[model samples]
Target: MVSLSLGELISSHRSRRNLSLSDLAEMSGVSKSTLSSIESGETKRPSYTTWKKIADAMDIAPSTIINAFVDTTYHPKTLEIVLAEVIREGWEALVAKVAIRYLESPRIDTFRALDHIDGTARDTENKRIKRILCDSIITFTRSRGIPSYLASALYERYLIERDDFSRFEETYRRGKELLLYTEHLYTEDRIDYYYKMGVHANILGLHDESIELCRLGLREDRTDSKQKASAYISLFNSCVYFGDIHVAAIYLKEYENSQYADFRKNHFRATLLAKKGQHEEAIELFRVCLQEAKKEGRISIVVDLMASYLEAGKTDELLRLIESEDQFLPEATPQHPYRMKTLAQYYRRKALCLISLEKFDQGFHSLSESIKYFKQLGTTSEVIDGIRLFLRHHRTNNKNLSFKNMEILEDICDNII
Candidate 1:
């Protein structure tokens, strides 16, 4: 599904009704500030009363917003962009076509199209022309179901660079299917396809699927322990997502002793500890991971381990590291481990941290951001409950919004083509 960003969904609904945020806020008994935050995904969890009021005010079944929030992986942003594009282009048929494709193909086809770029260099090597021709031929073959594994592989890479994983799982599905149907398509071609998908699934909160796919590679491919171990570690990470700490422990143990482990085991081990409520120990473990990864010259791994250290509340270590200012740090920091699931959780936790630090606005901002991503990702039901409560407490004044506006908006959304 084309996930609509939180901003897009709320704005579209507001715009079509010709209702201002202030107007809606007034009618729903929601505070303007709170409504803005909820609309923006900042206040990650709205209280029960808050959402009920917004639902009641908007005349939308509280269930529509509630269900939208619970669907966890709903395509809110996708819907937003398509809606906006339709509005811009005045192509109602195109909008309809996209919606149909969205519901039908949903994942793979969308990623392929979104990630498709041309006249770009995959590598700057001696066979530049060959890579270009290969990408072209691959794209063409995959389009017609000709088992062009290379094309699918290239498309997967494109998705990674762009960070557009709305259809991540779908691409993995299509790529895997093609590989299965055409054994000849199995070259050691797209290790990243497997690895990145594992990462994306972890981010999106599909931990089981993530680990399972990694296992598919570890068992099926000729990768050595190094590669296999990462895949295994990925599976270990998923155990946390599914909320089975003991299972995570079992997998963490496996990863810790793996011949494939390259000091990165420290971070993974620490992650398991943190999840198991051994937070203090986990913090120390990740500190060692940071040092070891730095020692091993694994830039990406070091960045990752550092993030884990930061997340697990290894505060003193973070402070000391900050004071020391490792001049050799990467240009950018790594994101939280899951990057997929629990985005709102990240914001919620961050907000708590900010609150503890007495940074009220910053804390609120963090929570609001969390709320937004949660809305985007369709957070857990517990989160939706909170959002609803927050909204009901809000006292917006716009009591009557016309369905005519919403209809106009949907028509505009349908014109994205």
Candidate 2:
């Protein structure tokens, strides 16, 4: 059944009964103005006695209306479903339509919807709706005049889905600014916000900031076991990135001791093992991690596991792994927010595998493709890292195949730098 606003549902039932607002008011003993206010959504939460009177007048169950409001407030999926229905019904009331759009398209679609709403002149019927819609959209899009807890949640989602680091940084700054002014964040919300901020900082190579954020999350008195585990993991990763393997190992042990150990913990352990030069064990663990991630349809984790393979210098094994998995093609576009970064890594690994097999021309071609993606992402860091990996491998194994290609690689690196 379609979910409707309390007012809309009440109005529909009253219309079906062929009763005017005045007639309903007369029967329910509610004033005509009160009935009109409720019907127009100007009064959302009526007194229970008033609601019961209205329900009695309409000859429907009061519980149904209560449940509808509860579901809309607490269940996001229910709200999304209701929004889909509202959109399908072509509700032209600006506030309802804007709410529908917000639920339907939290990201890009809502931006376009806001633009449309702004361009259209406000009518008398829509003035109130427009004000509410504009406030909500501004809170989300501009990250201003919004509650800190809500702004943090929205920004976290946006940051996680954004591919461009610059854009992600902008959103992060705005979220941080909003959060600074927020005074009433619940413990859970604060923990979640700090965790997301830590992860984002780690991704942007701000290891110290990430470590601090994770520590802050861990220090919260009311953090749950799951949140503590997550904070520990984040701290471990940040330390690892900062080249403090010992400290990372300590946090990793804490994470392992937590009740939340899972495939993620295993994956991090594999990374640590690889960093410690335990290639055989690390490769085995990564293999298991990849299988589990693939089973869960977490393709991003699978791709990341392949990077671990590269780090472990398992080029032949990585190539074999790629060939065995139909989903592990070098040319396919990844669905992750870090699509270009992942793609670059994939091609870089593929090139290293090909180079180790004495296929200079094909390997260089792959390397060039990796460079192209890195260029598109406005970063030469990955390309430089890939080049260094290639140089290290060439010095060890492929020295006889390519002094000429080494010159080309050096030239490419020089130009980019």
The most accurate candidate by lDDT is 2
TM-score between model 2 and native: 0.48
lDDT of 1 by residue, 203-296 (tens): 5566777876676565556645565566666777677667787877777777677766667566666766766667677667766765665532
- What's the true lDDT of residue 28 in model 2? 88
- lDDT per residue as tens, model 2, 29-89: 9999998898888887666567668878888754455444533342334444443443344
lDDT of model 2, residue 181? 37
In Å, residue 59's CA in model 2 sits off its true spot by: 43
Badly placed stretches (over 4 Å) of model 1 are 1-145, 148-182, 190-192, 245-247, 257-260, 277-280, 283-348, 355-359, 368-417
Error of 2 at 133 (Å): 5.3
Clashing pairs in 2: none
Q: How much is the lDDT of residue 158 in candidate 2?
A: 44
TM-scores of all predicted structures? 0.43, 0.48
lDDT (0 to 1) per candidate: 0.52, 0.61
* Shift in Å, residue 147, candidate 1: 2.6
RMSD (CA, Å), candidate 2 to true, equals 14.4
